[model samples]
Target chain A: MIELFNVSVQENKRLILNQVSLRINKGEFVYLIGKTGAGKTTLLRLIYLDLYPSQGNIIVENYSSATIKRRQIPYLRRKVGVVFQDFKLLPDRNVYENVAFALRVIGASRREIKSRVLSVLTQVGLNHKRYHLPHTLSGGEKQRVAIARALVNEPFILLADEPTGNLDPEASRDILELLEDINRSGTAVCMATHNYELIKLIPHRTILLDNGEIRREFSPAEVQQLKVIE
Target chain B: MSVFFLLKEGIVGLKRARLAAVITIVSICLSLSLFGSFTLVGYNLQDVFNRFYKKIRLEVFLDSSLGLDQLEKLKKKIHQNPEVEAVEYISSQAALQEFQKTFGQDLSSVLKSNPLPASFRVVLRPKYTAPERIEDLANRIRRLPGVQEVLYQKEIVRFLHKYLGLGIAILLIFAFLILVVITILIFNTIRLTIHSRMNIIEIMQLVGATNLFIKSPYIIEGMLQGLLGSLLAVGILALFVSFIRDVFYHGIQVPPHLYPFLLILGTLLGLLGSYISVNKYLKY
Candidate 1:
């Protein structure tokens, strides 16, 4: 579970997120919808403690931002997986190494790394692309590899920052579907995106963010109605 | 497991950044060479002083008009001094013989009479070889009855002792400066080399890699560069010593332990350089 208590993040005297309070429970799939510079990525970064909260406290699993030491940030990150929009895979490493890298950093055993990497690769349908470099993989497969890397450690939450930003429409659909599958398997996923159309596929909860604040929350029927009305 | 990966990555990093790695190794080589050459010169100078310190002796020239009993008494008195280790009485005739043996011309033939003075060649105890101590012993011997003058190599010892100390002090300063320059060179080299991999670093951090995990590879990379550079320096120095044997006389007196000392020093410097660069560059 993740909790942000009136969190405010600043970027050089400019307020990015102002008094934003958000909570994500286990197994919940929440969509963070906002326009460019609407503080969507900043919110996700705050959750991962990449950008510290300027004026509030955030609790990710057991680590409280108010009291967590600088050294404990990495351990906090291990429990919350982050998937960047660019897929940020090590260009030199193959798909297998890229995925296993997540587990490797957490000091996972060699046998655990091998087995878990394979299992997660299978889940993301990237088992066949093992040993293939990042440049060789398709956009869809690259996103899948990133997802597998995020999931290999079996984190409690997956903070996806535009997981399908660079993908084509068809590829985006596959990634969204894979995320839904992951959420169903009891892993909390907070996916940030501007694509309203993708919100209709599995609309559990969609939190609309505008000017660093949540404007509204929509249920599955409301998302469907909004899609129909639009 | 982490160590294995770190070492592998360190070797891999060298191959990946060949130019930076080469620059680091070359910089370390030059720095250590400067250090090694200074050490060689310093030790050789000390060797010169040690050679003369062992051979130092006072020539106690006796008065030409002294009676046989007075000469014997002077020799006995000089030998009784605690500083005197051994003394051999050389009469004017024997002195002339030694002079002829050394110069290949008998002093008796050169002059109407054997003019070389009778003296006692007084070898002092090793502890009295110090300039001040030897001066004190010489003064004591000069006061003996029928003794004309007490002579020892004071000027050469003063010159050697003065410059040897100054040379060691200067070398220490040079070593300190060299260490600083080498550390900075290595820090920049490794920092520049690893900067391009910031993306990988951030990704690793996002994936929960600890600071130690991120830093291990860079540390190991520094050590590798140091090891290679020092070995190259020692090999070149040994080669130079082998080609020129007269400086060392018989064999190069560079201690066998110097190799390991350099290796360890290089490794420590590498670690320090990497630690500094990592602390500066890796913000996360």
Candidate 2:
């Protein structure tokens, strides 16, 4: 459902992503493994229509990312969900409002939004914390709240950038499991992370990036072999 | 999206930023009050000119040497002019009696004989009050045999006309400048307020919020500010008008009819200022 063809992204006169071609099919769970400044976030931004490629083309759900008008960007965004590394929750709002915000932007009816937000919050194990503000929640709880917000709209794909970057080991494992369950429910998930240890445990399709290029793709057996040493 | 939702969100935003909203509304009210006062001054000045112009009459002094036939012929000729609305002839005796009544015993002892001349008080049609028309009528009256001097308040009319034009021009300029300044002030306030909410805007943009969905609340808030500001301005102006009337009770002859005009102008100014400010800041 997402395709990139030789896409190059440049910011501040430096190439961030160099001739990167990648594809994730429908319902496929893919993990993008890369080091710092390896263009993982840039690639996700390109697919989400937040930033256009400096060169080459990107196709997300059959819509050309480069040619879409500014007004059409919101519609495209509704079809895809993005989870940021910082959680990006409004501090003044409670957990329920944070998730309901996603549906509100899409002009969902109040009844449907309430039901959907409650169900999604319950799914992410955040139903009891719905009335708590973002600052009052723990790091893991905030991440779960962000995940619930992303999934509340029932998007076709979920692009998460280090969803567990701030969480403890136990909390990180719970988030990863929740993401895996979401993927199994038929929404394609593409998560970018640098933690090879978590990758060893989860065992998904892995695309490894080094120095602005996808240098390796590991199958299940190869991934298992790579994890044997860890 | 339903208008009810838009309104609810707008009210919530206004409530969240109540102080800023009140500041904006008060600023608008102050500016519109000044505008309304200027408009009232302009309206009343026009009324004064209208009243003064309508009372103007032309006086034609008849020559003492003219015979009765010549006087009758002069009157007939003066009536033929389209500018003359009505012409009434006053004989020397009648003029003397009117002068005696005005000056009383002092005037009766000063003059043994009646020196007052028989005159024609000519009232012109309202359309003939222009400078050129009055001049034309005066010139025509001068040509009559029995007419000695044809006098009207031509200089006063010309002066009032010129000053009235200048007054209107100055008022319009002041109004335009006030509108510009109000727009800039309100725009600055809104820009600052929106800056405080920039993170909210960014978050909304990231979550697939359409521009309309995001901007509707701000626009509705603007409208509410405008409505409330104008209402306050009108109320304040009403109080000011009442105070002025009490202070100048019977001293200044301001017409009571101008209150409605002032209220309308104040409301319009408030609405316009809010609209200009909101439109400028809400654009992406």
Worst 10 residues of 2 chain A by lDDT: A221-230
Q: Deviation in angstroms for B88 in model 1?
A: 4.6
lDDT of each: 0.83, 0.80
User: Model 2, range A93-148, lDDT digits (tens) per residue?
Assistant: 89999999888877899999989999999899999999999999988899999989
In model 1, state the lDDT of residue B179: 72
Q: What tens digits encode model 1's per-residue C-alpha lDDT throughout B133-232?
A: 7788889888877888988778976876687667877877887787777777777877777786778778878988899888888888888888898888
Of candidate 1 chain B, the 10-residue stretch with the lowest lDDT total is B247-256
All candidates: TM-score: 0.85, 0.83
List candidate 2 stretches off by more than 4 Å: A9-17, A33-38, A66-71, A165-173, A194-203, A208-230, B65-88, B106-113, B123-137, B153-164, B249-284
The residue ranges of model 1 lying beyond 4 angstroms of the native Cα positions read A200-204, A215-230, B1-7, B52-57, B64-88, B109-113, B122-145, B152-169, B246-252, B281-284
Give the count of colliding residue pairs in each prediction.
0, 0
lDDT of 2 at B278: 43
Q: Where is model 2 chain B poorest over a 10-residue stretch in terms of lDDT? A: B249-258
Best by lDDT: 1
